[model samples]
Target: MNTYQTLLVSTLFSSALLFSATSHAIELPQLQQRWAEIKYQQTGKQQESAYQALLTEASAARAEHANDANYLIWEGIIRSTYAGAVGGLSALSEVKAARKLFEQAIELDANALDGSAYTSLGSLYYQVPGWPVGFGSDKKAREYLLKGLAVNPNGIDANYFYGDFLLQQKDYQAAIAAFEKALAAPDRPGREQADLGRRQEIMQALSLAQQKAK
Candidate 1:
């Protein structure tokens, strides 16, 4: 082919590549918006419906970007949330599936989505029952949460979950500090609803921490 024709073809290919990347990146905000809305649902039945919808979308996104760590992390997050909404002994299996997704995401890119896998995995470790029943471990929870904090010190999830772990450990003073840090976290753009919800949770935790500290 002539030089001009070759250059035209190269430019078109580059544009196509850019378009593909942009399309994939756009899914993140879409997922976040859906998640925020799902979390806002009041009744358990409503939450269950919302979670199912979000999970369907998340699963599709994950399939589209099978190798994308961000998509994998989000899938895990959505799965974990859905499991919580399901609420019962059976939900443990769903959480375990979520853990596998999170672990796979970490393996692909530990820092993707601001080290979200670490934050979530840490939460699972503490939220699940310990001993003969489940794999929960306070020590592992703290360690993973600290790792997430190392990467995203100002992240709302990192601080809030860490504070929760501390609260569970009865270190009320430290819990207060972490909760305060979470409250001070900058609002995540395009995630206003999520931020609002998270801040409310932080305030509740802070209130309890304060009472315990006193």
Candidate 2:
């Protein structure tokens, strides 16, 4: 992949794993857990294949719970992850589709999974290519990230992604603060595995940001 494409994949994967909520709704939580296992435990083609099959289950869940915000969000999340793993211009469609689902999930209930729609949409806005290539803007990313933070001020995903945005902007100190907040976030009962993985990322990013700060 080219420079931009590689960055896109990396950003999407990082952001994809950011929205692990407290787990709700029987099947939605199941999807969430399954995604975490596939994302954190599996890799390469195995991961891609797992996300592919999960999409089928995600589709069924979304169809079954059309009005459920969590379902829409999870489906969107899975789609985004799959696209990230696939990596390339061709996956842009999946990204767009995921954005739509998140929008719908927000319209139904932004607070469904701790304002995950805002975080998800915000991450996508800033990470994707801009204008003729894709839709990306730092301004929009900050807007949605702040909204997500407002909804869930102490959420792990919210702080972590905001830290990432700050890191990208070269706001090292603020990024450090946000990453620290993410680390201090309360433990998510059913999502311990994902939390472990994410906290590792947090520490790594935090270390880098910290080094850059000095």
Candidate 3:
């Protein structure tokens, strides 16, 4: 090979090695932050390239910290987001992968972050469509969600998702109660506007559910 070609190959190899080393050194929190940033970008616009880059980084972080429950959960969440962006079969595969990751997290630490993994899995199971081979387990969904709520009665995600599930089941009163609990949760991590906006949306949904129940 020419000198230039030889130099290029060597540089590529060095870059790969450096990336491998750096990925191993990355922490779970950093990965989670990146995932969150990517999610924010996704909300603003359909920036596939940015999302892909974040997912690539997240995958590397996940590989380096395979035993961490938080990493596993974020990895699953990122995959699910990617799948949602690319719908159809790809989305289904992503959701399935996410479900497995959440399950793994639960297995490792069922009580982590007040049973966030259980709440996630519950919502996924409930929201995912019933199918011949993938997802759609209402029974499993309810079981996990209740488990989450049992662990932390005021868990935002658990209450919100369970409320949605109740609405689907036509248990309007139960749904309203759950929604109210979610809205009333104190000191949640988000800003006031975000939190209040979410509460407002839930209240609207609850109102609709109440009317339907009547």
What residue runs in model 2 are displaced by over 4 Å at the alpha carbon? 1-26
lDDT of 2 by residue, 1-214 (tens): 8999999999988776774432222487788899999988999999999999999889888987899998998888899889889888977898899999999999999898899999988988877777887777899999999999999999999999999999999999999999999999999989998899889989999999999999
After superposing candidate 1, which stretches have Cα over 4 Å from the reference?
Answer: 1-26
Question: Per-prediction RMSD in angstroms?
Answer: 7.1, 15.1, 4.5
Per-candidate TM-score against the hidden true structure: 0.86, 0.86, 0.77
Tens digits of per-residue lDDT, candidate 3, 1-214, equal: 9999999999999999998777564566665555555554355345556667767777777787878887778777777767666667657877888999999999898887688788888888887788785678999989999998998898666788899999988889899899989978875553444455557668888888879878
Candidate 1's residue-wise lDDT over 140-165, tens digit each?
99999999999999999999999999
How many steric overlaps are in each model, in order?
0, 0, 0
User: What global local distance difference test value does model 2 have?
Assistant: 0.90
Model 1 C-alpha RMSD vs. true structure (Å) is 7.1
